[model samples]
Target: MKAETDFDKAEKLYNQKKYSEAKVLFESFLKENPNNYKSIEYLGDIAGHQKDWNEAIKEYKILKNQFPKTANYWYKYGGALGMKAKSVNKFKALGMIDEIESSFLMASKLDLKHIDSRWALVMLYIELPGIVGGSESKAIKYSNELMNLSKVDGYLSKGFIDEYFKRFTKAEMNYKAAHEIGNSKITFQKLYNLYLNKIKDKFKAQKLKEQFEK
Candidate 1:
């Protein structure tokens, strides 16, 4: 009961973005309930929020090992590793790419309906060089898969890829579809960004902002 109460307090703090206070409570609770996976997951999230990617990686590794069947665990583990790779030298980043890809692939394979892992794979393939398995077609394949899972995500992802490749017109069409379908902040932002940053269309950007804000 005490452990549960402590965990609840920590989780509340964590949700409120009070990482330091939550971390203290979680650590204290962990001392009593060392095997608490939820507590460990919170610690990992806190570490990630603090940009302590190594700590995040360590915690997520434990999570993946403990819950091999959990796609979320593998996703978190892969995400942490990918963040670490971004901070390191190119050679080292190259070395870690396969492991990161494998983890995300495992997560995707484990959960076919998982959107996040597919998005990660899309970005991974799009960003990587051809030598390392980057392929525009592969990215499109995942984007299509995302389209099946969630139309908004699918359109948003397709817009992202089009923007990445400088297909501004295609991106605009897709972003518009996403906003029309979802009408959420993310969709709005994507459309706004394309007009403002990518296409440099102040008229469209202003019109979009006005429409979205209303």
Candidate 2:
């Protein structure tokens, strides 16, 4: 009962974003209840939020090993790995690519409706060099899958790809389609960014801001 209470308190701290406090309690709880998956997940999240990627990866790796069927664990592991790769030298980053791809792939396969994993894959395919296995077609394939799952995600992802390739006009059109269908902050932000950043159409951006405000 005491252990459960301690865990509950720790969880509340984490929810409140008192990460340093929660981390201490979680670490102590972990020593006493080594197999508590939720506690381990919280520690991993705190580590990620703090940019302690190695610790995050270590914690998530433990969870994925213990719960191989849990799609979110794999996704968390992959996300940590991707972030770590970005902070390293290009050679090191390249070496980590396969693991990152495989982890996200497993998550996507396990949960067909996982929008984030598909988005990760779309970005990965678009960003990877051709020699290392980048493919616009593969990115498009995942974008199409997202379309079937959620129109907003589908169009946003497609717009992201177009923007990456500097196809500003196509990106604008896709973002517009997404905003038209979704009409949410996420869609609005994408369109506003394209207008203000890539296309540099200040008038359109102001117009979008006014409309969104109303």
Which candidate ranks first by TM-score, i.e. highest? Answer: 1
| lDDT, candidate 2, 1-214, per-residue tens | 4456678889999999999999999989888998888999999999999999999999999999998988899999999999999999999999999999999999999898999999999999999998998999999999999999999999999999999999999999999999999999999999999999999999999999999999
Tell me the whole-model lDDT of each prediction, alpha carbons only: 0.95, 0.95
Encode model 1's per-residue lDDT on 1-214: one tens digit a residue: 4456788999999999999999999999999999999999999999999999999999999999999999999999999999999999999999999999999999999999989999999999999999998999999999999999999999999999999999999999999999999999999999998999999999999999998889
Candidate 1 residue spans exceeding 4 A from truth: 1-4
User: In model 1, which residue pairs have backbone atoms overlapping below 3 Å?
Assistant: none
Q: How well does candidate 2 match the true structure in TM-score terms? A: 0.96
